[model samples]
Target: MRVLLAGGGTAGHTSPLLATAAVLAEAGDDITCLGTPKGLEVTLIPEAGFPLELVPPVPLPRRPNADLVRLPANLRRTVKATLGVIDRVRPDVVVGFGGYVSVPAYLAARRRKLPIVVHEGNALPGVANKLGARLTTHVAVSFPDTDLRGATYTGLPIRRQIADLDRDALRDEGRRYFGLDADRPTILVTGGSQGARRINTTMAAASRDLAAAGVQVLHAAGRPEEVELDRRAGDPPYVVERYIDRIDLAYAAADLVVCRSGANTVTEVAAVGLPAVFVPLPIGNGEQALNAHPVVGAGGGLLVEDAAFTPAWVDSAVVPLVTSPERLAHMSRAASGIVRRDAAEQLAQLIHRAAQERR
Candidate 1:
């Protein structure tokens, strides 16, 4: 089977597509990725040894004036590019993970009469997924209560490297790799792959407080800020980086996590059974807040509003959890309950079924 996976813009959007593609590849499907040239997908897709077809960047305009100016041209380009790729690949199915790029890919799939699947990884449906859902043959979701109706709750598809880690070995390796004193509690702070400036500042200010309390920190400060953070927070008690390629190690070592509430991050935290304090990004139609509700509601994590986020709040909320083993254990159990490890398998099965039916 030939499958075309489409998504881009950020790691949050493309990671799940890569995860699903991995499963399909393992199942003997020839997988290709269609993505915007400058998006993370360009680097990530090629790094994974998958064939990546780059199209022009078609960023959705948020402002009225910009939308009026660019919409027609972007739409035309998107349609043309998508159609050209579809005709060339002749894929059996096109699976979209949700982003602006996914919109045209889905449309092209429909035009070709190929099976299309949309996987929404947010509690609220993204604009692209909302459009795709209407025409898609199957909708897979990360969160169970996502806005897209008629979607199966397949959880978020995480990369196999993280998914297949041996739990006990991961824990031991993580502790040693980060040079954490086995007796000290570890707290991981990340603002997604890009890093949140606010979160980074707050965590940096509170680093001393964390260290004074005998807590170790693994901070992913995004690309530009990683060096600054490393210079600011030196030594074994604080390990800082711009991006975490080995997230399994970070997740395994962390007793608690403070991060943004991107859908993929939330699900991955739950899958790894780590307690978290989620500070959703305060933008883009309040979607991140919606993503955090389920995890917060399940007692797996705390949802800290971006405006309410402060070093004190981080200290207050996280310090107690880290200090109390019982609380940490309960939160871990709650987090574990929120994810299904077979999410990718479930989504792949649905796609296969849909493709067969289409045939």
Candidate 2:
């Protein structure tokens, strides 16, 4: 089977797209990806060893303005480019992961009368995906309750490492790899690729208290220079890194995680059965809060608003949670079956079924 997948912009959309692509390729499907030049996909798709097709991105303006006036023309141009890609590739099916590029891909696939599969990664559906949902019967969402035209509760596709991880088995090696103490409780903090200023500062502010509680922190602060921790010679190691290339190790080392609730972040953390403190990004239509809600409701995690996740709250809530073995174990167990383990393989099967149906 030949599959053309459309997704890009950030890791939220790209990670799942790539994960599914990996499974499809291993099963002997020819995989091609569609993306906009402006998005991270310009490099990411090619780096993942897939053929990438570029189309102009149609960024819908929120307010009525010059961009809004130019929207139709821009969309038409992108749709034409996408159509050209589709004709040349001649895919059995077109799969869309919601992003600016997906709108054009969905429109083009329909114009060609091709089989289309749409995947929505957020709790709240995006406009591109909403439009795609109407065009096809196969619509899959990351969260269970995401309302769309024809929604199926296919869990978010995640990396192979996370899907196969056994935290208990790797804990000792992970601790040694990060140079963390064998006896101390470990917490991991991250705010995705670009990092979060609030999380970085607040975690730094509460570092002393956390250290005093005999806990270790693996803080992957997006911006290292901005988030400075006043470290003493013998404080429980508050190790900071700009980014973590190998997040599997980080998960193995952590009993708890404090991070943003992006779709990819939430799904990956939950899939690994890590207890979490999900601080949803204060902006953006409240989707992050919605993304973390199910886990929080299931007792797998706690959700905190950006404005309220202060150093004081960390001392009160986070410090105690890390020290309590019983609560951590409970949260870990709760987080364990929320995200399906074989989502990448499941999504691959769905894509193949869609392709075979078209025949």
Candidate 3:
């Protein structure tokens, strides 16, 4: 079967699509990724050894005047590019993960009468996914409570390496790889893939406090600021990195995690059963907060508002958990309860069924 997957703009949107593509490709299906030239997909898709078809960057307008001026032109360009790609590829099915890039591809697929499936990876649907849902025959979701009508809770598709890790083996490997004392608890801090300035700064300020309390920190800062923070931190027990390629290793290594509440991050955290302190990005209609609510409500993690996130709060809230074995263990169990490691395989099965029905 030939499948066309489209999504981009950030790693949050693209990574899951890539994971799904990897599964489909391994199963002997032909896959081509369509995305904007400027998005993270340009770098990531090619590196994954797949064909990437570039479309023009279509900016979603924020203001009415700009929307009126640019909407027609942008739609026309998007339709042209999408139609051109579809004509050449002639994919049997089109699957969109969320982003502005997905909209045109979904529309184009509808025009061609191809089967369309959309994966909504957030608790609150984005404009693109909302539009795509109407055109799609199936809507798969990461969060169970997403308001997309007729959507199924398929969980988030994660990389096979992560999905397949044995919990006990992961814990053992994590301890050895990071050289943790095994007795002392570890805290994993990340600002998502691009890194969060607020999170980084807050962590930097709280690093010494963490060290003094005997907490080992593995921080993925996502940029120079994190590296600088690492340099400033100095010595063993505290590790800092600009980016982490082996996220499975990080997840396996961490006892407690502090991170953004992006859909993928939450799913990965749940998959690995690591407890978290989530500071959702305070932007774009409070979607991150919406994503965190389920985990927080389930007692898997604590949701700290961006406005309330501070070194003092981190010390007060996270320090006690890191220092106390009983609390940390309890939270870990709570986290494990939320993860669905077989999500990718399950989603793939659904897609396969959908494709077959379309044929």
Candidate 4:
């Protein structure tokens, strides 16, 4: 099968799109990605060894202005460019994950009368995906009860490492890899690729308390230099790094995680059955808050608002949770049941089915 995937703008959209593409490519299918030049996909897609076709990004302005006035013409040009890519590739199906690029790809696919599969990775469907879902019968969603037509709960197509993670089995090796104690409780703190300023600073301030509690911390501070902080010397339990490429290791080694509740983070954490303290991004349309709602409701995690997730809260709440074996075990069990392990494969099957309909 020849599949053309359209999604970008952020890792939230692109990560799942690439995960699905990886499964298809491994199964001997030809895959091409359609993304805007400005998105992370420009580098990530090519690095993943897939051909990426560029399209102009047309973001819908929130308020009426000059950009709003230019929306019609921009959409026309982007749609034309996307159509050109579709015609040249002659793909069997075009799959869209929600992003600015998806709008044009969805429009082009419909004009060509091609089979379309839309995946909404958030609990709240974006404008691009809401529009795309109307043109296709095949719709997949990460969270259940997403407000979209004909949506199937496919889960997020996470990276193969996360999907296949066995925390217990890899715990020792992961600990050794990170130079953490094999016996002590481990906590992983992260805030996506760019790192969260609030999370990094708060985690740093609370580091002494966490270390005093005999818990090891793996803090993937996204911007280590930007924040003026220092790791305590003398065999410190707090291991701080600018970034961690092998996040699988971090997950395996962690008994608890303190991080942002992006769709990918929530799904990946749930998939691995790791108990978490999810701090949803304070901005946006409250989608991050919605993303972590199910997990927190299921007792798999705790949701903390940005303002409340302070060093004081960490000392009062997080310290006790990490030290309590019984509570951690219960949260882990709750998280373990919420994920579908074969999301990537299932979505690939849907893409194949959509392609067959075109025949």
Candidate number achieving the greatest TM-score relative to the actual structure: 2
Evaluation by TM-score, superior candidate among 1 and 2: 2
State every prediction's TM-score relative to the real structure. 0.94, 0.98, 0.94, 0.97
Tell me which of candidates 1 and 2 scores higher on lDDT: 2
Residue-level lDDT tens digits of model 3 in 74-93: 98899889999999998988
lDDT of 4: 0.91
Q: Which ten residues in a row have the lowest lDDT in candidate 1?
A: 226-235
Instruction: Give candidate 3 misplaced runs (Cα > 4 Å).
Output: 65-68, 175-182, 226-236
- Choose the strongest candidate by lDDT: 2
Cα lDDT for residue 127, candidate 4: 89
Report the Cα lDDT for residue 313, model 4: 99
Tell me the spans in candidate 2 whose CA falls farther than 4 Å from its real position. none
After superposition, the stretches of candidate 1 with alpha carbons farther than 4 Å from their true spots are 223-236
Error of 2 at 293 (Å): 0.8
Error of 2 at 352 (Å): 1.6
Which scores better on TM-score, 1 or 4? 4
Ranked candidates, highest lDDT first: 2, 4, 3, 1
